[model samples]
Target: MNTKFSKLSFTIAVSTAMIASASLASPTVVSFSDATATSTSGSFVADNAIDKNKNTHWEADTDGASITARFGSCQRVDDLVLNWYGTNKYTYSVQLSKNNGATWTTVVSKTSGKGNKNAQNVTDQAANAIKVVGDTDSRLRIDELKVNSLGSTNGCTSSGTSNTSNGENSGTSNPSTGEVSGGNAQYPADVLDLSKWKLTLPISLNSPPNSNKATEIKQPQLKTYTNSEYFRLNAAKNGVLLKAIAGGARTSTNTAYPRSELREMQGDGTESAAWSCTNTDHGMYLEQTLLHTTTKKPEATIGQIHDSKNDLVMVKYVGPSFANGSTDIGKLEARFNNDNITKLLDSTYKIGDPMTIDTAVTSGGNVTVNYKNLRSGVRSSTGTVKMTGIIGSCYFKAGMYIQACSKTDIYNNTNTVCANKNLSANKYETDPYAYAEIEVRKITLR
Candidate 1:
């Protein structure tokens, strides 16, 4: 018996297995779904490069045609392959953005970029967008841009059923980094990381210049209310408190969604001060604990999308009904301003209980949503359904996205629809006053 030979065989087997696992976990072309590709040059389009056909190319006579594709949301990019109509005068870089676009980090750069098929295993970066930027002096053309990421099993998505038209980008979006290990790992955090989240308040009803459409009829105004004072949290030294104050008075019959909101920004896309809808591929997720709430027993919205027909689907807590039969109250709840509010999961969850929420579109074109109270082990769910609209994207917003409204606002269309508003306060307070208060200890988004 040659002991050395036996050992060598064993080592080969282990290495082979590891390689196979990695190959199995290779990325697919999810960048194709719900992505917005843009180029500086008008004649040469960025979409041509991502069009899935190598023959179709994006070219520009001018140097620095700089083409970029921003995903529907944030995603993890591990490896990328580029087919270029090269130029010795130009160097190309594979840039990554975690914030919406405020900053960029180059993960792959090449000076020897000319007519070539180049593949690079870039440092795995959780970015919301990727770009093929060329040096200023050199003309550029990209025949194809292929990427293999860490989500889904769509055969690396080079060809065949992997095309986005198939409507089954099963391995497409939803950064599955945390889901790849032993089990769906609980995202860990204790509010010690401020870089992990971003808070949004309707501090001003003024539409963000980048926003695609204005969702409100009028942007509110306030004096003496500081945007810096909205969130109070830093390290564990002082626990994170995301407070939402109902600013301004409801003088209109049109409904308004004028509550403070916090959006998670740690993954995929770069953060921006602009309020445009993020272009994403996989999906968006947010999880937090219900530390506290201080309003009349109104309703609060939770995350989940049932199907394509429905936009902005969230589970609502509708305290009690006054019309005798229409309310979502169970009555064994807690007290917020002395009102008995029905609880999600249980009474304990009403105050300081952990809750997990996920919103992502599966490769199979299904809208997937799930919510759970970590303390009570209770989950809110929509089993399954064929989610339509491939040419669409969604963003996540949390913290008092108040569903409350003036009854007149609903019918007149001045404010957000009544059904769209979740819970409410006894009296939606005025400027410099807080009607809803929720202390969020942890928030994780993938």
Candidate 2:
């Protein structure tokens, strides 16, 4: 043979030897089941019980017979053992339920033998009974079947007590109804009885003025009381003197105007201050004018004085040289008692400092006035000062002119004295006058 051929043959032999060594080094077991039965009886037969010799043996057959056991009143059952013999095929299943023979639930199913073992526990909460059903050939056999309860008590009690595997007690009790007067009072709905005391009737506003006269009526009629329980009536405009009535008899009469007492209480309640406009036509205009005039001036002086009896005098006015015309003036002084004025004075003012007015105007044209600066002898310390009144003046004028001249005497005398004096004259004149003024005085503060 050629040398190359011999080398090739040697290589093939070495490869074959390595493959044989690998196959011998490791082995594996493949499991399968063959049908074989040892039990002849169709029920729980002792000869079919599983033992060590029959642990791996089992059977499967066309006949669907089974071995079953009643678990009694147990919530859960487990740890069932099944032993088989010989290499064979077998099918098995476990059934369970809560109701005694009425219903059942399947827990486990398996095939046995054919070199495979048959062993398992049937664990289920509703398993009150178990049925092991299987079929097999003569070569397979069962040696034992064992089972045990899951919990110490094995089942639920009639009183709803269920013991867990960890020894915890899960017991439920009925709920109790609450008591009134130490005993429960039954009511259709959850409610507290409030029938003992009477409820007060709701109060109402006074009747509106001139309900029938459309011209006199200024606003739409509103309910006397927006919320009323005992009696309710729509606003009436017929001037019939309507009232909140019960059983056709008047319970409360409506007034033509709001009661003064209620008006006073309105200050504390949710009701706003009663706005009364003498004439709606000019109401807004007059209100704005009043607000502007009443506004306090900046740089107003304030002072206080004490009498022999120790009573205090307060005075307020514009600066000494300034006139109180229609326009708001600065340097007005407001005075109060020494004690009172001292409290009013803030950190800003010294004895001769000009007083200041803090004025605020609201949307409704309501004006608020505050006076600052209180001095000693120069100004009283306890008094009221306000924009007393407004006096407005307007002026108008027409221009005119007049002229004078003389020439008749000169012409006659000139005729006698050689008529040389020429008589001529010219003149011009003018007149003009115009003025406007307004005055407003301070009113005392109340």
Best by TM-score: 1
State the local distance difference test value for candidate 1: 0.38
268-325: candidate 1 lDDT, tens digit per residue: 2334222122232234334454433324434555333322123334544444433121
lDDT to native, each model:
0.38, 0.23
- Please, what are the lDDT tens digits per residue for candidate 2 over residues 1-446? 01111000000000011234355222121110111121221221221232223332222112344433333344344444444444445665555434332234566666652324444555535444344555443222234433433232244322211111111112211111000110121220111111111111112222442211111101111211212222221122100111111111111232111000100002222333222211111000000001011111112112222222221322233321222223433333333333243223233333223332222222222222334231221211112222112122111000000001111111121111111223232110010001111110111100
Query: Over all chains combined, what TM-score does candidate 2 have?
Result: 0.21
For every candidate in turn, the CA RMSD to the true structure comes to: 17.8, 47.2
Quote the positional error of residue 349 for candidate 1 in Å. 5.3
**Candidate 1 displacement at residue 28 in angstroms:** 43
After TM-score superposition, the amount by which residue 7's alpha carbon in candidate 1 deviates from its true location, in angstroms, is: 25
For model 2, the stretches where C-alpha displacement exceeds 4 angstroms are: 1-62, 72-75, 111-116, 121-124, 138-143, 150-446
Off by over 4 Å in 1: 1-198, 205-229, 234-239, 248-255, 264-285, 291-297, 302-310, 321-349, 388-391, 405-434
TM-score for each candidate, following the candidate numbering: 0.37, 0.21
